[model samples]
Target: MNQLGSIIFLIAIFLFSTFLNWYVFQAVKTLTFGLEGERMKQIVAVSYWLIFGGISIWLVITFLRIFQMGEINVQTQTALNVFLTVMVTQLVCVVFLFGEDIVRNVQAGVTYLVNGSNGFSFPERMRWVSGIALVVAMIPFSSFIYGVTKGKHNFKVHREIIYFDDLPDAFDGFTITQISDIHSGSFTNYDAVQKGIDLAIDQKSDLFVFTGDLVNHKAEEIDPMLDQFKKIKAPYGQFSILGNHDYGDYVSWSTKEAKEANFLKLKNQHKKLGYRLLLDENVVIEKDGQTIQLLGVENWGLGFKAKGDLEKALANTAASDFKILLSHDPSHWDEEVKKNMNKVHLTLSGHTHGMQFGIETPIIRWSPVQYRYPNWAGLAEENGRYLYVNRGFGFHAFSGRVGIWPEITVIELRKTVSSME
Candidate 1:
């Protein structure tokens, strides 16, 4: 964005954040109003402002550094994470506090209307209401803290068995393990990341695919953990495709040639890890004299990059053949993949990371990202086509995974008995 637009955006964010802080501060004052001593009240007030002001200043400095230098260090990322966690906690407290104020004012107004203004007084803030607000706010605050400390590396293996009527007989019961969004630059704990890689290795799937975002903005990010990821090998082969971030588009470079060189280096990293990096291309995996097509396209999504050529990727492939597509963003499946004339039996993607935060249980699955991408996580099917979106292998901007932990997806493709008959 231009300089003036950026300034306006920053001002808007500052005003909104200021409003939230003021609202939460009022609740804090109400909660401590009945304290025993003047000194105690002074202490409480000072502590609250000190903590909030410190985080706010840190965030402002971090953002300014990012704007000027086009870089974010580990310390800056940590500050951003802390600011988001605290802001979310304060928002929860503000909800309850606002409700209490509305009810109290309404009651006071009714009393004044019924009686006269003589010796009338507004209702004092209730300690019980403020107490409840503070207590409830702890739930999210604690959850966010744990998410940063542990949840990012807490990988969960999700398994799905999809039955396809047109699947080749030889490939029946074939398992493909998929992992996406490795975001290697954000990793801080090497041992924890190694454990996640070991879990994927244990799955023992026939084929393995990495759907993208191997690095955050540069290829060198994967240098430290290259060996760990190389351990994920399957019997058939390991394949990969790029995500939007792989092109180094997020960072500002000194020259166009520098960016292109970085992109070339990233592709070479995939080969170093023993993966066949597919760039709008197809390769056939053969078993028992029968072949199934595996097509991979570049990063293509509705709002993001559109480098993937679906038609070119499907070139020379028949409609009747069993085909599996590897695209990074799930929107490709929703917008183009499923609707293509040359049908793809299955499409694997992983870009949302389920927003790295949301509630998912046996009963309800909900994330804010769902509003943006209909097929945000897990499996979604339409007619005979299937799409499985891996939650992600790592975290990004937020530096944490709350309820939506990092994921390794294992999919077993089965051919239906009816199709054989």
Candidate 2:
């Protein structure tokens, strides 16, 4: 479905939540405000109210994701920032205004009942009802359409080093260009895709890595951009891994063999494009008169992602070598690489894509996925280990980004210095 259609479905959820909350609210009010079993009513009422609204909102958001649009350029996002700013600001203001009145009415309802019981006047009840009316009037503003696409191809040289103490000294100063979640099915237009690939090529990094989800579902989704992806080059080589979406898990197919064939075809296609497909295996990049083991594990994640064995892939290795692991999901860095396999020092991952949406500001930066993981965006460090989550080279199901634009990340690896504190 299209973005507008998915948004309409969310509106349906909003309506359902409204009805459920109202029905439950009325039932509770009657029990509490009258001579009835108020305690039982409170339990059931609270359950219905919270569950209905929360679940509905979640479902609506998830469903609306099917409309993921093409990414816009950074220039475009900045150009439209002024107008989008006004729209988002005014819309949020209106939503909050009604939200305030809703709170006032609830408080007033309790106030009126308490006063009436104590022999005071009932005049305040009308005010409570009027406040409720105002709250109801503000729902449309809360449903405003935000400027979702923050755009993709803005190039600023970020001279940052993503380092790890355990990194092999031989591989220090290694620069790499990484792409993940291209999802070309949703990437609309030749110009945008070309621009994104051009940015990656312009980095001129030693090695290039593609983490996964190259297409949304089938192989055909990416055929249009095959030549563009082949253009990405590095002195060392290019490597890739599979993402959960690449397995054709989300769609219904004629047969399992056909789906498997499609995935294998994609793997072969990667080979045709001069990328080494890493399927639960490892590759050694010989550079700078030394070799560093590049261990590429299959798809794996903490909760939502599929599991692929990283240990089996690294079984032949010595713990002392400088190692860089390419695992699709960043959550793997926290759950597995950080502890169970501490030997894997520098890990590169991209399943999160910062959840494809994050706050784009200097102060108090954040993304919605922040609720899911502590180290949710940009570069993350813990326990002398390093994980860099790419924002992504392509767009996905949401069709547009608000603050978080689609990204092309260039990372330079530096060796740990010898100076003492």
In model 1, where do residues sit more than 4 Å from their true spots? Answer: 419-421
- Put down candidate 2 lDDT per residue, 45-162, tens digits, no spaces: 6786566555555545544443342223333333233333333333343444445557767776787777755654322223344345335434422321342432433322333587
Each prediction's whole-model lDDT (CA)? 0.91, 0.67
Candidate 2, overall lDDT? 0.67
Q: What is the lDDT of candidate 1?
A: 0.91
Q: Give the best candidate by lDDT.
A: 1
Which candidate number would show the highest TM-score if scored against the true structure?
1
